[model samples]
Target: MIVTKNEAPANISKAIGQENVTPAWARAVTSFPPSDRILSTILTRQAERYGERILLVAGEARWTFAQTAAIAAASAQALIDAGIKPGDRVALMCSNRPEFLQVYLGCAWLGAIAVPINTALRGFQLSHIFRNSRPALLVVEAQFASAIESVEAGVELPPRTWIIGAAAGASDARLSAVALPARGAAAPAGAVRPGDTVAILYTSGTTGPAKGVCCPQAQLFWWGIYSARALGIREGDVLFTTLPLFHTNALNAFYQALLNGCTYVLESKFSASGFWAAARRHDATVGYLLGAMASMLLAQPQSAEDSTHRLRVALGGGVPPQIHGPFRERFGVPLVDGYGSTETNFVFAGRIPPDRPGTMGYLADGIEARIVDENDSALPDGEAGELVLRAGEPFAFATGYFGMPEKTVEAWRNLWFHSGDRVVRDPGGHYRFIDRMKDSIRRRGENVSSWEVEQTIQSHPAVAACAIYPLPSELGEDEVAAAILLEPGQSLDPVDVIRHCEGQIAYFAIPRYVRILSQMPLTENGKIKKGVLRDAGVTADTWDREAAGVKVRR
Candidate 1:
């Protein structure tokens, strides 16, 4: 099922227009392959078909499909030389770079599972993953070695380690020492299958210890195909992302580009001010927006460069409603926000008949999804419920949480992959995201969507980014609390914030305590660490309208 450059995909009809995401078309176009997909095979096919076509670009470095394939093959030999065996987990703890690709694809070449660790994780959090995965080999960026070493006092690190981008240390051999050229044959043909584990990415763990998500080789291929087709990604489209490679978002982008014979542009991190300029420079035709990226882009000084790029559409999930349309109009590029996760990549995206602004698009291909209640009964359309999805084919979804059978069984209860997200499906055949089941807040005997609260407050003129969560109250229920980041050169009084919410939201949903931060503390995956904010509740510097005797009326 590997797509050769410009070759017609099997079972797919002529490409549908942007407006067509119907289940009928999904069934027609997505013919799941009979054989299990292997990433090594896909890369080899792409190289043979595309050859000199540029597939990856970072800074001034541009790698054609042939070159990338070669490096990956050589990288596999390096892993083998390091005694990495098939099925052994090789932990990769590096920032986004060409090297990350080498190791990730290299491991795939050997059927060694790549464990891409979030680079931002430190100390205790970092140790938890090491203890859990227990990878045989650890490939780390030189900068993080000290922090990784610090955790080794109490926990066992991987037995073997390779330092990339090593700064003059006359000690350990750098991975480059054992590297081979890509043209060299490394392993036997068809040594792996699509069902074989390719990667084990650690979850952000909003509520508990991070679990490793087992992503099969086939799942990543499906993600790329789903993303490319859903967003109408053209052959010349250069998929751009500033998200970390450790996350599924970037990996999907990379594979999406390769799967379609397009180029992929990677950046170390996102920059709001220079975003459009960079897009223009790269001739980026498509990109991704996530978390508060869209909001931050809107906050940047409006420039003519916004519309100057070849960039046309951006794919993402969870864009703030108030800015969703405005961002498109202002930048002259449409943003298609979808909803999915590490477990299921891009299950729903912008579909036919166009959804109401703020809705989380319609369903995507190859899956049967539903909104269900606590008892697993399907809820009527427009009723808020948990979103559970099941793939038509096995291994299309993540196998399960790695090594956690109890949790896996619990999550996949009743034979549905529970998403733990609250959403509403429209009778008109669209869907709207409500909130995370775990992140909901109870106030004044009413369940308030923290997502709704955050979106409303984020629309304020001065607010840059925010997280609204429940703060424990002596009265038995939770009180609303907001940890906010103000726009540069903007300021607001806590009283004004309460007043702003007076008519906009439920009276009970208004924040009682406001903690303004220069920047929101984020998880390794760039999601706001609401749990950390909840733990650091109402400091001396926190503004309390109730303590100040400010009256709030319903």
Candidate 2:
């Protein structure tokens, strides 16, 4: 149904306890002029207001607001020394570390576009990103230098490479490589506007290669404002997250800390066994968790350390509803559910003690939502339809998909960004998520492109045809499954199929269950009927990789 912020239901108004009133946080942040919404300006303002306060912690490295601002200036100077200019793309491939943020803030300081690549990507996927972004220089961690070298023949890489934590013999002879340069003299911040593009983050594609989403400066500014409000962040709060810096969730956490005057703690990665201990060690008050994280934590043996941490709440997007209460009862922390995307801001959120258990809460103040049919006509409140959105503030959402004009036009058709998720708006104005309308599978917090997986599997010589689809996973997410119709005279084992895909695709994209069929279900045309195969799910005769004790590593 077409629902604007003004047309919100009375029940939702009462549930949220605000009733058309602007939230204090939103009012305070929006009161500033548009010029103040850029990242460089935000950094300066925060440093001025919270000088000497610890702002970031990664491993043993810590930087205060003032120190971070100085580092940003130095980083900007370093990029300029390396021949980077405003609007140039600088690719960065690194894990969760201090340098990731250093380069990100430096890009904002110099008006360059930072392109953060997923470290898990390899082969064709990595090559596609290098070709699409066309970075001027690549700043890569030492361990990942080989991945760039592997794809050197397929695409044109940047002119120079700066290796972090340089190791002997890690440099490639074909490219101009050097150890990461020392900090340059401090440089002045560039004059950037709120509408300027600051980053291009690539998300998994449904029918084609991954597309880079062009995020404007004001969009991330609003991300910090809205996410902080949703998580109930307060000054002096310790924000902790184990999510990788390549994705929006972790990046948003950094802004949440920056805008809220909190301290952000970054860990290298997530481990269910060490989660609580890490939280306790950091004295974290606010935490972040994505798909399957909470379930994995619950699966750990009960311990006294669960309730010992100081974590009051966590931003638990994509967490299962069944474990919400159980987790809170055991850990003394609440998991707030919310909805957002790489191209969108924090659009919907619930309160600490959510009124409804599983539904995505009412729309935020500066956004409008619509539940529409295939023809873009509004549906009834109870009927399910595709959820589309529009932001009220100027430059508050991503401009478009980078270098893909047709995809951008198709996604933003009719002046609204189309979300490919099917949802239903209840009479009381709560929206519940249904299955995805797009052909994508989400596994362990990563979006696995079924089209890409199918392309990789079909490259095998013995495979005549293949279909990839999602199977119900016990951890409240989808698992990849493949159905293959082999060549008439050839026989193949499922393990061999996985072996062929080892370095070609991501480990998570490899199918867990495989089935071989003599004939395949077909549509009226010649295309395979993936819906029929998805309905059949994992059969008793399917070859199970985990059952066979086969493991795929990064």
Candidate 3:
């Protein structure tokens, strides 16, 4: 539902207030030493103050704040020593691990720009990013080193620049050529500021080739502050991250943990069986999730083990607030809804209890958001329009997409960054997501929201997940087409699904074609890959469970 600018959202302040339960120490730290420090500065400070405290825990290895800082400093010095000057780009390809954090912080320390590539990408897709960023240096893992080696054979990188992790084997010549030091040394004489560009994170390649988002160091530093405040992170909190390091969610989580003087627990990836166990092992108070992560956890038939987690918060983005209550009630943990993108970081977030079902929570303090139509006219409350936001808080926005000046200009047109997302505003100033502007389906001169259709179709008892799209109709126009995933052991009967949708949705909104799949194609981040589905065409050639005309109700 679209919200008007003046309309009040349902009473959701209670939920917002509950999430603001910040600890005393975190609040004290924010006030005591009010200095503008980069992430590297925060790490160095923690090294001095909490030298013995475990700053990072991954696999069987652990690094204290002092040790982590020393390694990062040495690594930074090694890059500088290798002719990697300030502002050079460094691409990182590794799973979620301590080395990833080291690379992130180490790059910051050296004033080089970090470009973390998604570990899941392969061949041409990976090559595209490498070519786009044109990094002077690449810090890769042994497992993915071969992919880099293959790319290196064809594309030459700048001299004195390839650094591989321990996985490269102890005797490898390339590893020695780019070996990082084991101790700290004085950084080269140069001034690093918060306003300097620190990293260029590529957007998830769901729509097309990803664009590099240029985030200023000062903005990123401030992001740590706003995120910490919004999520209620604390000094003693253990932030658990299973999301890929290449993604903004994990990197932001790591930065937030460091700023709060908290311990960060790293998991190579997300697994339902090991999720809670890992949290308990590290005494983690907070965890991160995407909507698919929650659904995957929910799909794993209920067990008493489900309620055994020690997590105080499972905060992240894309979770439909519809499942928020059930997810919390089932796991005995609160799900904090936050919204951000590679282009914009943490623009809005939702708090704990009293969170209205389906709402994206309230706008973060100091951030301003509005619903504007295609003509850039601001819409009143209850109307759905393109969501635009301006930063009121520090590190709240991105400078632009690197090397794409036109794209950057387009994104930040009229002063506010265009999120390209359709959203509704409540009278209370909170925004509820409707759908992506590109994700909406147009049929019969009417707009059909895929998310609204997907939500209603998913209510079917036999359906596990659904992806709705627009397809060519006999009427020489587009019509709705839906691909559904069945609940385990449940079979898909197109006729039954049509009957179920008959009264639940409008006739125009109902899908004309229903295809069942073992699974829906998804992006690395688990968002439904509608483009892939669209390419597959509307009607199923085979594997169909119903006849051509499967109409049920009018």
Question: What TM-score quantifies how close candidate 1 is to the native fold?
Answer: 0.75
Per-residue accuracy of model 1 over 1-554 as CA lDDT, tens digit each: 11001112222223335343333214312433536367777678778878999999976679999988887777888788778889999988888888889889889988899999866555455677888888988888777565564353558767677777764332333223222223355654338888889999876443455678999888888788778766777676788898889989899888888777789999887888878888888888888887467777888887766677887778746565666677878887777767677887777776422345556676665678878889988888768898888877557789888878887898899888888889887665577777667776655334456765786688889999989887876443477899889999999888888887664554666788998898888988999988889888778878887899988764
Give per-residue CA lDDT, model 3, range 1-554, as digits (tens).
22222222233322335344555334534643434456566677767877888878888778888887777777788677767878999888777767777777778887899998766444344566777888887777766665544342355443443444652232323333344345457564235766677889876322344578988775665566657665666677898988777877778776776667788887988897778778877888888877557766776778887878678887746655566777888998787776776677676766655356445767765567779999888888888899987876555578888887878898899988888889887776677887667665645433455765676688888999998886654332356788888999998677777666654444556787778889889999998888888777854442222346555443
**lDDT assessment of candidate 3:** 0.69
**Order of models, best TM-score first:** 2, 1, 3
How do all the candidates rank in terms of lDDT, highest first? 2, 1, 3
**Residue ranges of candidate 3 with Cα displaced over 4 Å:** 1-35, 149-190, 205-208, 439-539, 542-554
Q: Could you tell me which residue pairs clash in candidate 2?
A: none
Among all windows of ten consecutive residues in candidate 3, which has the lowest summed lDDT? 1-10
> Taking the candidates one at a time, how many backbone clashes does each contain?
1, 0, 21
Cα RMSDs, all models:
11.7, 2.5, 11.5
Off by over 4 Å in 1: 1-32, 167-185, 188-190, 352-354, 439-554
TM-score of each: 0.75, 0.96, 0.74
lDDT tens digits by residue: candidate 2, 344-430? 889888766766655577677789889999998889888999998999998889999999999999998899899999988888777
